[model samples]
Target chain A: MEVLVTRQINKYFYEPEKFQVLKEINLTVNRGEFLSLVGKSGCGKSTLMYVLSTMDTDYEGQLEIAGQKLTGKKQDELSAFRNEHIGFVFQFHYLLPEFTVLQNVMMPALKQSKYAREDIRDKAMHRLKTLGVEEHAHKPSNKLSGGQQQRVAIARALINDPDIIMCDEPTGNLDTYNTHLVFDIFRQLTSESNQTIITVTHDDEFASKTDRIVQMSDGRVVV
Target chain B: MAGNRFQLTFEIAKVHLLSKPKQTIIAMLGVTFGIAMFIALVGLMTGLNDFTEDITMTSAPDIHIYKDITKPRQSILQQIYPNDMVWVYHQKPKNELTKVRNAKKIIELIRKNELVRGVAPALSSQVFCNYGPVQLNGYILGVDIMEEDKLFGIKSKMKEGRIEELLANREGIIMGKGLAQKLDTKKGDRVVITTPEGYTMTLKIVGIFQMGIGVIDNVRCYANIGTVQTILQQDPSYITDINIKLTDRHLAKKIAAELEAKFDTKAEDWETANATFLTGVIIRNIITYAVSVTLLIVAGFGIYNILNMTIYNKMKDIAILKAMGFAGGDVKSIFMIQSLIIGVIGAMAGLLIGYGLSVLISKTPFNGGDIISLDHFPVNFDLKFYMIGVVFGVITTAVAGYMPSRKASKIDPIEILRGQ
Candidate 1:
């Protein structure tokens, strides 16, 4: 089944002047597919990623995710949809520094509130263990190394068992070793468990190793 | 599911507040002192009100029954003989004293009422107290000593001499210690009273009392009802006033109205008799609350500034919270809960502090010769004052927290993440 489909997407930035950022962009991703969007800086890849994740509702488009039309939804409804179906990994890790790694991972699950607290805790621990950060679960996120924090952030993204994980330069702030380690985790997640991932990246090697790469120059996508 | 969401939100708020311990403490203390001052000031104001009520009520009867000053007979005569030209020209004296007839029957009727605690008949007349060359104008109230003592607590106020001696000796009188000082007389000395009806009599001073009220102490004297009636050249049974005490003093007004309607006489309760004094107390009460609430709101502003700064600094975390699927409303409640926690803790601390301060003030003694001499300063520690403080504190804190929380909630995640 198609997990995400965007039709005739158009976005603009009104600052300085009415400037078109993305024009007539169209894309689709299949279930369990691992795709990378590769582009140079200021090529609208991050903007497309934000639009696809339902975080940027200013664009004019038809966006259907997980078989549900998400266009023109209220912010709360979109938030609930993101909580249940879509997870995000940002470049800076964005783990709440005041919380323990386990707590940070459990935040989205707690927000979902579909399961008991104990069940959420157990699931959060399982995700931490899967990411090889369970031993550091009780430590505050700010106390972790750069690589460890990124791994914990990825674990947090997966705690809700979301269908699609959208990462905006997830490994952008990491060393090559941690970058490859995150790449390996994403590859294993898709191949072993059918958890789809769409990542926007500037790393040429990272894009080359993905199942498929959609390269962009200016605002047009070229396979 | 909704309940679980609130738990998560509270956890986040708790962590955020704890992360900045100093700011949170400052906010809590602002509310604390605000509430403490509210309780303390209200306590003192109400305490003074109670004290004034006690002093006024203790010295005077709960209800005073006197003859209604009758209007001139011309109006009634004209109504009976309307358009009679000769009656319209006939007018009676306006300043004539209207005496209460059948005083014995009215006293007997009031004494039988279940609510009535004491009833005493008194004959009051303005007289001149003369001690050789020193002459002072005063009013003499003639009373049955025992009944007056039960109603007015007069025996306890005696500075010298005995009130019962007035009953034994018809020529004896009890005067205020201040009046005795002004008249240059003492207990067992002779003083002359010249009545308005031109009857002069010499009376031996039997009791000297001090009520600590300047006017009453300086110009009031008491004598036997029969002696006062004889000196004023009136019937032995004729009395100008009937003073009453009730089981419940607060019910005096209602009962006084009833007595006025039933007996066709003027009845005045302590509330109406001291209307000006009560009005002053009420105004003080209003001023107290106004000042207290203003102080509390000022403290609320301090909380607002602190929370505003915290939210500004935590913009990134707020954006991340939203991106993690917490709705704007959820984020707003998280900050509100933090303020509520601060308010509740501050209120509790403030109540304790206020109570301690009140007890401390109550222990401090006021020396004699001050405005009103008392063994200690009066500070009422009423629970209602503390309750007002807590409620005011929480409301002010919530108002203060609202604006900053709204700013935090509206933070756009895309905007913050785009900074990367």
Candidate 2:
């Protein structure tokens, strides 16, 4: 089943001058597929990822995610939709530094407001245990090392059991060991739970290990 | 689910505020002092107003009934020489004064009313006091002694001799301290009193008192009504004014209106008698509110500045929260909750501080006869003042918070992430 589709997507930036940054892009991703978006810097890979994640609504495009048309939706509706069906991980592991790891993991589910708080807490603990960070669940996020923080971020992304997990450089700041560990976790999530993932990364080795890689150059997908 | 969302928002707001203790404390202090000043100053002003009303109402009757004095008829010469033309003419004898008639009947009618606590008929006349080759002119208020004393608390104000002495001897009079000094007379001294009608009589001074008002001490005296009427060669029933005390002083205006409509006479209540003082009270209140509200708004600006800086510093965090599926309203509510917490705590502290200050001021003595005539600074401990302070503080902080929250809500997540 196709989980996301983007057709004729175009984006422009008018900083010093008006210029097209994303040109007539077309893409689709199937459920349970672990895909990676790889490109050089300034190749519009991050821009396309942001547009697909429903974070950038300014692009002229049609975006359908999880069988719902998302284009032309109001900001609040998009926010609710994203809360229910999408999860995000960033390069910096954007966990609230003041919150415990467990609390940070439960943030998205709490915002969804569909489950009781105790149930959300139990699910959060379970996700942390799966990521092998349950021992540090009560510790503040800032107390953890870089690799541990990235793992916590991944746990947070899976807390809501979302249809799609969108990530920007999931292992960009990790060492080789942590990179392989994160890749193995993604593989297990795709094969066992059939969680769809779309990630943008600069690491060619990590992309090669994924199910498939979409390469981009100068705002167009080259392969 | 509803409870969970608020808890989430409150948790985030609490973390943000606690992380920057110095700025949050500064913002709280702004609201604190603003509310303190408002409560204290308003309390003091209200106390002063109450004090003034108490003094005036104690000294004067709640309502005074009298016939309206008619203006002198336009002179025939003024009729002929109109439009700013000046013409000199020989002065003619003045017409008879308009005196309140049927005084006995009116007094009887007023005394029968349930609202009337007491009614006293008073006849006042301008007179001259002569002794030892010195003649000083003054006004004499003729009263039934007991009734007038009850109406104006004159018995309590007597400084020398007894009010009953005036009632015992029809020829005895009570003169002001300064008037007695000017006449160089003491109690039991005889002074020749001459009315405006040129009738003279000898009267003994039985009492002397000082009313604290310079003009009243200098020119006022009291005598029996029969003596004054005999000196002026008027009938016993003639009286210039009727002073009526009411069951409730606040009902004076309403009673005065009814009396005026029923009796075809002008009635003056204490509120109308002290119009200038009432106007002063109203103007003072206006200035107090204006100054306090302005200061509070300035305090609100201090809160705004702090929150605005916090929002700017937290832009990256806000972007990530939005990317995590937190709605814009949720983001805005987090900041608003922080402001509300600060407002509530600050206002409570301010009320305590302001109340302590007011009590301290009320305890400090005036020591000397200051302009306000109060022995100490009057401070009212009305609960409404505290309520006003808390409400004002909360509203100010909320408004201050709203602007920065709106700015936080409008930030584009993608733009912030890109910048990062």
Candidate 3:
């Protein structure tokens, strides 16, 4: 079944002058599918990722994620929807430096408040174990290496069992070894738990390793 | 669910504030210093005001009913002329009795009034105290000793002998400290007194009292009404003044006006008699409030600046939290909670410090020389001033916090994340 669907999505940037960024983009991704969106610089792939993640609402389109229409909802309602259904991993490890690694993973789930605090903590530890970063769980997030911090970010994204995970250059700042580690983790998530993912990346090898690739040039998806 | 959300937000706020311990403490101290100064200044100023008011209240009656010695501006000639203006150049003044007429009946009527606390009848006479070969001119006031004591607290002012001694010895007189010193007479010494009417009497000095006012202490003395009446060669029914103490001193002006119109006597209220002093009290209070509020506002500005800088520094954290599903209101709440925490804790500390400061001030020795008998500074420890200080401090901090927190809440996560 399709976990996310976008119909004729169009976006514009008004600064400097009126400019169309995304042109009638139609996309769909099924459950358990891992897809990569690749494009040249300023080709609107990041903008599309933002629109799909429900963070950028200034667009003209219809977006349905996990069978819920999210195009015209209030900001707080959209935030609640994002909390329950979508997880994000950014290029930089966006862990709160003041919190422990385990606390960083538990932050979103605590905000969701769907589980007891102890259960959330246990689940966060389990996710860190799966990501092979459980040894750093009690350490402050900023104390970890770049690759270890990225793995912790993935653990945080998985703590709430969201329907979809969106990533913006998840390993762009990582070395070759860390990039392969993150790609293998994404592959395992999709195969083992039927997790759906859509990531924007610049690495051709990383895009080729995913199950599907949507190539975009000049704001239009070509393949 | 709301409780849980607030708890989460408060937890985050706690972590944020804890991470910057120095900044938080500095902001809190700003509020603390402001509130402490406000409490201390207002307490001391009001204490001084109350001290002065007490002196005035103790020595002066709420309303004094006496015969006016001033001749009427509208004379019989003006009354007869009706619409015409009549001018009398260098007209000689006519003598009139400076005594309240029907004194007994008026006192009885005033006693029936529910607002009257107590009434004391007195006869005032200009007298010459004879000591050796020198005679000093002064005024001798004749009063009922017990009634005067009850109304003016004369017993507290006595420096040498008891007020009851004047009653025991009908020929006794309570002389002011300065007047007794000038006459070189101590308690138990006989001083011959001659009234302006040339009736002479020898009276024993019974007590030396100090009223803390230079003019009154140097020239005034008190005696039994019968003794003063005999010294003035007057009958027992003669009374020159009636002093009335009221249940509520604020009603003195209205009651004085009413008494003046009804009895055809000059009635003076305490406020009218001490108009300039009352004005000074009001001006001091205004200055106290103005300075206190300004201090609090300055402290609020300090909070504003610090909070604004915190928000600016926390831009990345705010963006990440928003991306992680925290709403704008949640972000706003986190910062507001931090501000209020500082305000409440700071205000509490300020109240304690302010109380300590007030107590220290009250214990500091102060000598007012010969004019006023005060040994230490007066500091009013009124709870209401503390309450006002804390409430104002919190409000000021809340306003200071709101502007920056609102700016924080309006931050767009996409912009910050996109930059990364």
Candidate 4:
């Protein structure tokens, strides 16, 4: 079954004069598929990622995620939907500096409040253990190394057991060893839990390892 | 669900504030100083106002009724001519007695009214005091001693002898402190007083009192009404002034007007008689509120500046939280909760410090120097003023927080994420 779909998507930028950023884009990904979107800089791959994540709503398209149409939803409703169904990881390890690593991982689950606080904590600790960052959980997130913080960010994304995980250059700042570790985690998440993974990456090697690759040039998807 | 949201946001707000303790304390101090000053200034000012009012009310009656001497407007010619405009030049004044007619009957009618607390009929005459070599002119008022005491609490003002001594000795008089000093007479000394009509009488000084007013204490004395009547060679029923104390002094003006029309006498209320003092009180109150509000607004600006800087510093954090599925309202609530916490805590500390300051002021020694017998500074600790202070402080902080929080809420997360 398809986990995400976008039909004839278009986006524009009006600063310093109007310019089309994305044109006539259609994409689909099936459940449990690990998909990579590959393109050079300024090819609108990041813009398409933001639109698919529902964080950027200024676009002309029909977006369906988990069989639910999300094209005309209110911002708050979209936020709630994202909280429950979608998770995000960015190139930068964007953890709150003041919050402890464990607390940072527990934040989204706490906000969702679907489980008791203790259950949320245990789930967060379990995710941290899986990412091999449980020993650093009590320290402030800012105190962690770049590779360690990225792993913690992944742990945070998985705390809510979301249906789809979206990543924008998730290993862009990591070394080869840490990058391989993150790729293996994504592989296990898709194969074991049937969770869909979508990522935008400049690394052709990383794109080749994913289950499917969507290549883009200028603003259109190419074969 | 709402409660849970608030709790999460509040926790985030707490972490933000605690991360920079120094900045939070500085913002809190601004509100603290503003509210504290408001309380102390208003308390001391109103206390002084009440002090002056008390002195005035004690020395003067709420309403004073007497016959006014004036020239007749009609002059007989205008009344007989009716429609004609008659002019009279250098008109002589009409013969009218200064004493209120049927004073006892009028006092009885006034005493029957529910608003009248007490009525004291008095006869006053200008007298010349002769003590050995010195002769000083003064005014002597004769009153029923117990009634006068009940109206003005005269017993509290007596410094030398009891007011009851005047009743025991019909020939006794209670002279003012300054008058007794000028005459070089003690409480038991006898002084000869000659009325304006040249009738002389030797009266013993039974007591000495101070009203804390310079004019009254310098040239006024009190005696029995019969003694004054005998000295003036008047009848037993003669009364020049009727002093009325009311249940509520605010009712004096209306009751005075009614008494003037009913008794054909001139009546003056305390407020009309002391208009300048009342104006001073009003002006002081205006200044108090103006300065207090200005202080609170200045403090509010301090809070606004701090919150704005906090938002600027936390721009990345806000964007991340939004990207993590927190709504714009949650972001707004986080900042708002921070300011409200500061406001409530700061205001509570301010109230405590304000009460301490008022108490310290009230304990400071003050010398009235024969004008008034006060021993310490007066501070009115009115609960109403504190209530106003706290309410104003909270509202000021809330308004200050609102703008910055709204700006934080409207920030587009994609912009920050893309810029990074």
Error of 2 at A167 (Å): 1.0
How well is each residue in B151-206 modelled by candidate 4, as lDDT tens digits? 99999999999999999999999999988888898999999999877899999999
Which residue pairs collide, candidate 1? none
> After TM-score superposition, what is the CA distance of residue A153 in candidate 3 from its true location, in Å?
1.1
Predicted candidate 3 versus true structure: per-residue lDDT over B28-60, tens digit per residue: 998999899999999999999999889878899
- Give DockQ per model, in order: 0.70, 0.68, 0.75, 0.71
Per-residue accuracy of model 2 over B1-420 as CA lDDT, tens digit each: 688789889999999899889998988888888888888899889987887666667768889988776533567767887776766565565666546878889899999999889999998889999987999989988889899888878877788999999999999999988889889999999999988778999999999976655467778899999998898888888798899999998899999999898888888998899889889999999998887798789888998898899899888789988988888999999999988888888889889988988898888887424223457878889999899889988999999999999889988998877665
lDDT, residue B236, candidate 3: 90
Q: Candidate 4, residues A75-111: lDDT per residue as tens digits? A: 9998888998888898898999999999999999888
User: Considering summed lDDT, which 10 consecutive residues are worst modelled in model 1 chain B?
Assistant: B366-375
Off by over 4 Å in 1: A14-17, A217-219, B67-98, B109-118, B128-138, B155-165, B180-212, B246-265, B367-371
Query: Candidate 3, residues A1-223: lDDT per residue as tens digits?
Result: 9999999999999999999999999999999999999999899999999999998999998999999999999999988888888999999988998889998999999999878889999999999998999998899899999999999999988878999999999999999999999999999999999999999999999999899999998888999
The stretch of ten residues in a row with the least summed lDDT in candidate 2 chain B is: B366-375
lDDT of 1 at B132: 93
Total clashes in model 3, counting residue pairs 3 or more apart in sequence or in different chains: 0
Q: In every candidate, what fraction of the native interface contacts is reproduced?
A: 0.65, 0.65, 0.58, 0.56
User: What does the i-RMS of model 1 come to?
Assistant: 0.8
Query: What are the lDDT scores of the predictions, listed in order?
Result: 0.88, 0.88, 0.92, 0.92
Q: Name the TM-score of chain A in model 2.
A: 0.98
